[model samples]
Target: MKNRNLIIIMISLLTIISCENSYAEIRWEKNLATAIKKAKSKNLPIMIDIYTDWCSWCKELDKNTYSNEEVIETAKKMVSVKLNPENSEEGEEIARKYGVQGYPTILFINADGFVLENVGGYVEGEKFVPYMKNAIDKLGKINVILSSKEPSLEKLDLYMESGNETEATKIFNDLLGKKSIPDEAMPKYLLGFGLIRAQQSDYDGANSYFDRIIKEYPKSEEVYMAHYYKAVGMILSGDTDKPKKYLENLIKNSNIPNNIKTQYQTLLSYINED
Candidate 1:
């Protein structure tokens, strides 16, 4: 019985090892610098898997998401890297530089060494390819814009659609000085960034951005959104008086869209207590 059980255990161990090898066979570079160098030499983007020892989601992402054949195949086309930021000094520095607040941050880095996007959270295998591929595509789109002689809002629009804010901002500043894009295109992006800041609880930062749009792009449809977000930020920042006055002013402004005014009108009403 002991001999039989030993033989079964050996077979199971071999089977598990073989299964693991077959699934996730990414050529993972541990060092970020080495990966960046390799990617730069090949004109390829880098895919960084930022993980930590304590994150169960990170382990699951490795076993389930990276194990997908499509994901593995897609990852092969780029300079793939895996790093445990908790365990390595280099990894921690890289992760911190990219705003990695959570484990399993799938960072897409351009060949120029810019972290275009640091997407967090864990996704399943089937959904992984498109997410990473979109990251790679953002780098390509940004590169095309940088390579062009003049800035193009149309091309920048493509980058925005990919949701790579880091790449978009760099391209915006590099190709066009401040406020180069058409007023219509410019305010929306600004407001989008403002919303991001607001979500991060940077109320002052968010309000500043919103105020810029309200002042510079009064005719823009985004101004209404800017006003709403600014009010929310102000209220969150504990300014009970200022945001109320701002919302009331927004209501009085004929430029604000009627629908937008109506949407947040209740919040404005609530602020009138004092």
Candidate 2:
């Protein structure tokens, strides 16, 4: 058994080394503007590394994370750019625009200039690979949404469906700034905002939005979902009793879909089991 274990470990090490040797390098662009232009022309997404000369973690990222075979392979699908915030005025301006306060900030931007994801701080190769994959997945979905002639609010819904909260938040905030939003759209808008806040782990903020949807738009189609999410937020906030009662009430009195009612029942069973 000992000999077999040793052999297995050796084989794994050899495979890792082979993968490392196969990828040459990620061809990194020096200028952000040029990288963006190439990405737009080629219909590719952009990956920007915001680094500084004096940042040790930045060098470590180049040495460790960037050298990972998976990261190199994934980076090939996008236009990669490296910008030093202290190197030029343009770099400084762009860094400020993106709110890049930390060193070695990685930004994945779609071809149309919307940031798909922002990864802050130093991350290991194993963890960093997933962030790149998520950004790429979001980029594809956002591009499709952008090309469609969907109405602006519907586009926001599409973004939420695609799990592109960064873009959705931008549109949501912009719409909120408007003097008046049609009553027909307000329930959906509030629900979307609540979902975003929930994703951010701000249960209080999320519940506030859900409350608005339930109270202000009681007759709207989104009210039932608002009730569901509010219960979820309460559950996540470490209080299961209130949500349990709320779901019980919903299950008894609400005319929600059978499938949704089943989901609520399952949640209640799981909560009871816990």
TM-score of each: 0.64, 0.53
Error of 2 at 162 (Å): 15
lDDT (Cα) of model 1: 0.78
Q: lDDT score of model 2?
A: 0.81
Clashing pairs in 1: none
The C-alpha lDDT values of all candidates are 0.78, 0.81
lDDT of 1 by residue, 1-274 (tens): 9999999999999999999886567778868889988998887889888888899999998889887888888887789888888888878877655556888888887766555556789989888787777867777767777687665675556455444567667767765675667656778888867865765677888888898998898888888788788887888788898888888877887866688889679788777764
Q: RMSD, model 1, all Cα superposed?
A: 6.2
TM-score of 1: 0.64
Off by over 4 Å in 2: 1-23, 157-274
The local lDDT score (0 to 100) that residue 50 gets in candidate 2 is 88
Worst 10-residue stretch by lDDT in candidate 1? 155-164
Q: Per-residue alpha-carbon lDDT of model 2 for 1-274, expressed as tens digits?
A: 9999999999999999988776567889878788989998998888888889999999999999998888888899889988887977757866766667799899888765577788898998868988888888887877777886533665777666544667777776766677345769888878877877787678899889899988888888888789888888888889989989989988986567777788788878877887
